[model samples]
Target chain A: MSVLGRVRARPQATAGVALTLPVAVFFVVFWLVPFLAAIYLSFTDYEMAGTPNWIGLANYERMFADPGFLNSAWITVVYTVCTVVPTIVLALLVAVPLSRPGRLNRWLRALVMIPAVMPLAATSMVWVIIYSDRGLANTLLGLVGIDPQSWLTSSDLAIWALVVMVVWKSMGLFVIILTAGLQALPGEVYEAAAIDGSGAVTTFTRITLPLLRRTLLFVLVISVAGSMQAFVPAFLLTGGGPADATQVLPYYIWANAFPYEHMGYAAAMGMVLLAAMVIVSALQFGFLKGGDE
Target chain B: MRAGTILRAVWLIVAVGFMLLPVYAMLVVASAPDDTDLRGLVFNGFHLPENIGLLFGEGNLPTYLRNSLILCVGTGVLDVIFSAAAGYAMAQLSFPGRRVLFALVIGTLALTPMVLVIPVFLIVKELGWVNTFQGMMVPGMISAFGVFLVRQFALGIPKELLMAARVDGAGEFRIFARIAAPLLKPALITLFLVHFLAQWDNLLWPLIVANEQELWPLPVGLANFQSEVGITYHLTTTAALVTAVPPFILMVALQRYYVAGLTFGGLKR
Candidate 1:
């Protein structure tokens, strides 16, 4: 057979290969190459001004001893827990009622989701205003008969302030997700529970929670992964804060790579972040799957 | 039952209010008189146009907006096209390396761009694309999420249709363009909006790659405005409002598709 005939004989194989080439090529150049380069760079000392020199795990050792890395790791855990837990709970609280079928509920759901769609940088700017001493937060505090307090400037409160903004920005998406999960649930189960004289709280705890475990796990994994690498809010709003209180992992990596010229160290930190995310996701999957029985 | 209905309504209203308060506060500050204090600015002033004008007039916000548009539109179009083509192949065609490619794409989905910033920047610098539009747009062009979304939608396309086209001696590309592309409109729209919003809101990558005023996108531009304008709430909030307008309009207009896109990955699993 001629080459054209040979190729034409299996249209699926030829066309599939041809069609997949663009994304494959792009992914290789953009993602694969960069990913491997990050791994390689983590082991080398590459100042922007010069060629990289292989240093072989020195960067990793330095990170283990680095106070900034330790601070950022601690902050990452705190930030992730603060943002992820509230986002899941608040989203669930709002999504359950909004999941009901009605035009008004749909509109209300859209309204609540508006913040999730806003540009984080812009929203962070709004938050900077809100968290300012004279901003609405303090004003609202005054309404409650409390003293006006500096929010972002206070080390103890800066990370918490960021947590509030992140939850506002992120929870809506989870709400939508959980709402979908709620809608997908079998109505027959709820009907059975009602016939059995199960109360709302009892049905939710005994049935709804267990049934929605997979969806909840999905939300948990995504939220935790996102919060671990959060950068823009901390950078734009706090600039890593008054005493580095809000210096999460990604911010620390950025500061090292750009401002401090510690490219190897930064890449090493990125590897750590990648590992942390994988571990967290794996743990969630394992725990959730174990509960299936 | 009546009490339950009222409680649900109240809960939703409170949630929506909490969600919108920051946005509403932003609008109030953006429209307030320049020297007004935050306490005094209680959605009373109506100087939105003037503040917007000042934002574009005194700063490089217009340039930033233009650059951002180019970046977002470019990323969106390319992401859609690339994802559709690849997704169609993965979903319909039988090819070698298909499984491995899908796995690779899925793997990339787990690796957030934030973790790859330093190496990606190095790659861009190596390619001589720093401070260039390509630098800002290319790495963001083909997200694994877009590919996965398109592939899932493409799986629903009837295989017989493609076979019939093949029997009629239609070209593969022609079959995709004539059949698959039209059928994948909803998914394509979802991918486009998601990619557009992502590119529009992206800050850190652009901040690193583009240092020139003309190359700055809205997010970076808004960040710089904070430093340059000091504590001028009117101008800063005005700039932020402008930065937010595109995605906000998109979300409001295409809420269904946008939400579908948001929940696509989660629900599919």
Candidate 2:
């Protein structure tokens, strides 16, 4: 029996298939099915109704002329760029110093991660109060000797207010990640650079950045993807706004999906967003794929 | 010391201040009396218990808390198992279609889950799972990121150890249950905590599927209260505190597991 079993595909192979089967089933039913369905649904007008009417490319075409969709597409782009840039930069700033080996840096690493752990819906309430007229915004402004701007209510500042809050929420995790990445770089190179009398900026730009490309690329992809899917803040804090200033694509898509019952339309927009994530991630890869071995 | 050592301490102190200011504000407002002066940052009274009682009383918060707990546990426990099992197989075993299965996991990574929300909802509804716990928990039980993280961690397990176990005539499932699973402790804990956090913060799917208040989790319930202007500042702050305090405690207690996630493979979020 042992010889016969050995002659066949390894007896342990069944265990592998059995072990992998659950996630595979989940991937198919939840991931693959929905993915294919999203693609198919984007092409049809299903609206939670009897039958999905096939109208090839119509929803995608309508997205262009639709002002709401257009505004949201633009807002999403703005939100992604604004949030991603500051998060990476600020996180890098905090990371560079905190990367040093010390008990303070170690403990501070967890301290910085606090906001990232807050429930977005819960934190949005706090921000609503902060951005309110008589709330912390005005009080803080009073201390700083600057007038309080209506943060969320003002169309001009609403998105930026949310951007600032999100940068706070996001920057910490990246700080920790970047800190680890910085710690992992070869130490001898820094020693060589120090011997050459290299300045801080010079060593960073010349030696550190190139070595840190993979981590930065990883961080960039994560930040970009996360920023694009940011819905809770806008949904809970701004309600897509005094105008549609804060109506990110996900917000707009949610609006269409539930409130307006534009399921097919939302799916189409979602597909576009998915494509945007893929493209942006690819671009980050390509752009950062410098002449490193 | 490095050139910026003193400067670095000052920088981090300010950043910590920024990081903690909201939590402090939450503590202050959460403990204050309802309809108190919102202009100043001071405690009106130590009414945190009273405010929390309000949530437990009329806010329907107990239900929300219970649902959130169940959702987090269900998803977290399942994600750890499914991910670890699948990851173990891919890393350690010789399977017929290992490459194909691994490719499937990779394929999931390329697609954004946000986009699939509609179709996933629709499918769940079709399965008669709308407004059900299973509906919310099942769709997200397995994360590709979780699978990849587990696989990365599992790859570090010595090949000879598994081979030795096999040579000793132990069944594959038994060896995995008794040996491999125990060895993957840090990865498992990390996966659990990460999924727990994600599930606790899950709002969007539950928002649509759980249209009824009875089924709403804290995130959805909190959003509902805020959106409709029904929830008070005290209750909002209290709920924020209530939601945040658990994770803060968890984080402080298990800082090692959280950091272990970063050290393991990559971002598990």
| Prediction 1 TM-score vs. true | 0.96
* lDDT (C-alpha, whole model) for all candidates: 0.87, 0.84
Off by over 4 Å in 2: A1-8, B1-3, B227-230, B262-269
Candidate 1 C-alpha error for residue B200, in Å: 0.6
lDDT of 2 at A23: 88
Q: Against the true two-chain complex, what DockQ does each candidate achieve?
A: 0.71, 0.65
TM-scores of the models, in the given order?
Answer: 0.96, 0.94
Query: What are the per-residue Cα lDDT tens digits for candidate 2 across B1-269?
Result: 45578788988889877877876777888888874655537878788898888777775778888899889888889899889899998999888889988898888988876678889988899899998888888888888989998998899899888778777888889989998999998889998888787778888889888878888888998887654445777667788788877777777788778766654443322
- Give DockQ: model 1: 0.71
How does model 2 score by TM-score?
0.94
Clashing pairs in 2: none
Q: For model 1, how does the per-residue alpha-carbon lDDT over B47-113 read when each residue is reduced to its tens digit? A: 9998787776776888889999999999899899989999999998888899999998999988967
In candidate 2, residue A45 scores what lDDT? 91
Clashing pairs in 1: none
